[model samples]
Target: MKLSSLQAIPRCFHTTRWSLVRQATADDSAEALDAMETLCEAYWYPLYAFIRRSGYSPEDAEDLTQGFFARMLDRDILTTADPGRGKLRTFLLTCLRRFLAHETERRMAQKRGAGLIVSMDTTWAENRYLHEPVDHLTPDRLYQRRWALTVLEHTLRLLKDEYEDKGKGVLFEHLRPYLGLGVEPEQSYEAMAAKLGQSLTNTKTQVFRLRQRWRELLFEQVSMTLDDPSSEEIKAELSELMQCL
Candidate 1:
């Protein structure tokens, strides 16, 4: 998704760097495991995509992805994550590169589906990979693009849940497209007002509010991936991610 429309969103602040990493690496408690699992679920596919771009077959990529996570969890590799180094996106990709270099032979020798640590929807992952545009993106570039999309997807999910909780689930579905640029003329505010049974003015107002909330949520989501980023740093990161799209 192009993020030009979201450029106006204000910066958001949050204390703590690599809170999720810290939580995931803190101990072997259930909470820590849950944190680690959440990270895995959010990012597994991007790593998978990277592996595929690096020339692994889908089956091999699936096995390697699973093995990488298994090794990460089993050996408590996250304990080595340093917030001062950079974002989690960079950290994971670096670790994955190292794993592939040293552990590929050992991991590939194991039976398929052995030592599964984190559950993933490999079927869905492969389908998504199949649909990707055949572009000139290198493995690293594709990883960054996928990572940006992942963040946007998570932000949209949060927005959807918020609207659903307020009994405006259907309205959210209609307004969602307006949160981004390039909505067709046929899907104009007047049409939305008619469908929503509200004044056109009110429909426009709702769209504005939706876009604002989306910006706020997107900012918060991006902020979480950094290590106590300044406002300028967050904006720069967002800009780079937007370029990836």
Candidate 2:
């Protein structure tokens, strides 16, 4: 669907998120450079995971990932991204695949960490990679799962920050496990109420409100990636991402 059709949809919450993508496509103004940096920081891990799964050594993968971002920014490749074509993740993955196929030799020959574009925590990334299942899923499948997980992690972090800002950090900690379906909470509602100095009914209500806000935030997060932020498109993307989990 075209983004113009969704013009009437309220976009106050999504403007900042989508602006990063839109701005990154512009000439090298400060805002555009900052936007592209933020996108790379948030999304570099999934692409790295894809590369590692594709059989490159950790050292080579790191070099390739850094080189890809460096080339992408220096060469103005992001100017080619057309939101109307599809989601941003798809565009990035396609570019990364093409880079791997064509640029491996040249990138590997370069000095490690030469022209680093994004600051990635290599230790954290490698540790995370070590924990992934040893199943025979293809690299593409691993990338999809990693992308879905990254979105969920980002959304939860946002929610936690909001709660902390309101001085409800402890409440959020207790209620977090209940945010996911089928994940049993360690404490009963009655016990939680007593600990928080609230009635059992109030505790239940808080849980309900938390879950509701999570859904709202999740929807907004998914909407930020779409060219057409229509309700139907958002729902379809959310469904597909959830299935990847």
Candidate 3:
């Protein structure tokens, strides 16, 4: 579901992600293949970060993440998934964990683009992977945190596009700090207000709207990962996203 539709059901959640899963598991389905490929492109970083935290070098992590998706898509292994028992997040991680433990027997370098499921920028992926925080988080926790972050990043990008499309790009830039990714403005809100030709109160109101929209986006993003998340589950996921920040 799109973020724009989120406000219509403020206290409810629905997701089209299950259809992505269902189609992705059908035999000889191009739609399924496309769905899986899109998901791989969007989510490969979390799997790579999980691998890196498990002591793989950046190069190895890149190879394995690439190779894993290659095998998964080529073999259509997701067809074996049981919709009754698996959430997409758990299913993907379960497959990755198995791939890492027992399925790296193939030549990693050779498998890099073998299936051609998705084109990954290994150079970009490696450079970005290297900058991940060095901390005491276990690999599983790291995976969860990265998953949460990817969701936020996606939401922010969409939000930016929405503002730009509405001719509010400059306002979004100035009010961005109040969206609370811990961004500190180079200048105070008073300065930002003067520069934007908006009163300080108006600036605060715009930021409030941005933040409200952001929370809705976050809820929608997290809810998409689960099959049928309740209000409590969504709230818990929201809390986890906050903690990850």
Candidate 4:
């Protein structure tokens, strides 16, 4: 659902996310995968960046992060997500962080550790994760990265629903290259234009619009998470939350 859609839904309670479990189970795998794809687009980068700052080399970070997602899918973690206990974001981050910490030493510097692993374009992941300023990164910086990623993920979902409703799903997919994953210059403008069946100039304009809409949606999502809240309070809470990452 888009943030606009979410806005229309009554803000009955912040602690009501458990209601989502019923909706999720009612849908099939395609629906589930779509939800997950939305999540991956939003989150993969922040987590990758976190791992990098945590001291993994680029390749190892990419591998570990990709492996993390593989486990998420294989184990059907989303299916088991218990939202009634807390916000979905906290639930996801808590699980992922613990899982990685538990397995980090065992995984070591290995190539494709034993398990059901999806072969991501780890090279692509590496390139995308490199955009962050790597100089003198600290734990606090990594938390900030995590917070930024959560905002982007929420934004990406809202954008996806908006585009889908407009029959612009193709545009969302094409323009996504520029937004979430960072721009791939090797992915020629012409290539993206062809994918969306729009002129390169139009593609550029649409992307800007998409980003603006997403920014508003992100602020909205963060606001929803607030209880004893002000925008500044929410931002402070967010900052503190990321530090634990």
Using lDDT as the measure, the top candidate is: 1
Cα TM-score per model: 0.87, 0.87, 0.81, 0.49
| Clashing residue pairs for model 1 | none
Among all windows of 10 consecutive residues in model 4, the one with the lowest summed lDDT is 1-10
Model 3: ten consecutive residues of lowest lDDT: 1-10
CA lDDT, every model vs. true structure: 0.80, 0.78, 0.72, 0.59
| Candidate 4 residue pairs in clash (backbone atoms < 3 Å) | none
Model 1, position 56, has a per-residue lDDT of 94
Q: What is the per-residue lDDT of model 2 for residues 141-223, given as tens digits with 9 covering 90 to 100?
A: 99999988888888899999999999999989889877653356567888889988989999999988887677777778787
Candidate 4: segments with Cα more than 4 A from true spot:
1-29, 79-85, 108-121, 134-143, 146-216, 219-245
lDDT of 4 by residue, 117-193 (tens): 34356677667656655567674466466666567566687789999999989767767765544454336667767
- Candidate 3, superposed: residue stretches over 4 Å from native: 1-14, 27-34, 79-86, 104-111, 185-191
Query: What are the runs in model 2 whose C-alpha is more than 4 Å off?
Result: 1-13, 16-19, 25-30, 104-109, 181-188
Candidate 2 global CA lDDT score: 0.78
TM-score, cand. 4: 0.49
